[model samples]
Target: MRSEPTDAERALWKLLRAKRFSGYKFKRQVPIDRYIVDFICFNHRLIIEADGSQHAENAYDEARDSYLSQQNFRMLRFWNNDILTNTEGVSEAIWTALQDETSTPSPQPLSRKGRGALEGAHNG
Candidate 1:
């Protein structure tokens, strides 16, 4: 893991650290098996990644995601630009993912449609 977090990671960490986000605990720069995730909530088996342009269409990330999915860990990946520029939107998305009950111990990862459903539930 990098010794220092990026600007986006630092910003998101502020919102997630110390149970500031909905009373859920979050840790940064955590290791899970062969991969080190940006942030993780063990209670929900959730991992959040603050990604830069290097992550776009990354095959390694896809494989890593598949591995994590098999372990019943839900991943939320946000672009660095989005995290830095639209903090509220990123937080809301994270909140929706955290509120997702359907992610419980599932072998399959949460699909885009599933996330959209969650968003609809919140908006409705």
Candidate 2:
């Protein structure tokens, strides 16, 4: 539960929450340790960050991105204005990135079932 992200983050959240895009579940304001990310899809180890001008001066953010990359997470960052105005293009870019089979990161998130938890899901 993130303190409701910025306007730009909210806009993208609307498009990502509830598996709305390509049926992937993206969590908002997820805290991996001390930092909270705008969106994280653990299934694909994909992180979507919508950055504002302040991010330009945040050296800490750069360090975080590098750490995430080293942890096998693919970080996709979009400028706030770009995401707010060109949602379709943003979505397309995400789709295209996901479809890059040759460069797709491996060791995908394991299924809950593999760990003996069924997510309390009831099958019909």
lDDT accuracy of residue 49 in candidate 2: 74
Candidate 1 error regions (>4 Å): 104-124
lDDT of 1 by residue, 1-124 (tens): 8998899889999999999999999999998889999999998888887777676556787778878887888877776666777777878888877898475432232333322223312110
**Each candidate: what lDDT?**
0.74, 0.66
Off by over 4 Å in 2: 101-124
**How much lDDT does candidate 2 score?**
0.66
What TM value does model 1 have? 0.82
lDDT of 2 by residue, 1-124 (tens): 5565788888998999898998988988888876677888887777777766666546687677766767777766777776777777778767765665335333222232321012211100
In model 2, the Cα lDDT at residue 19 comes to: 88
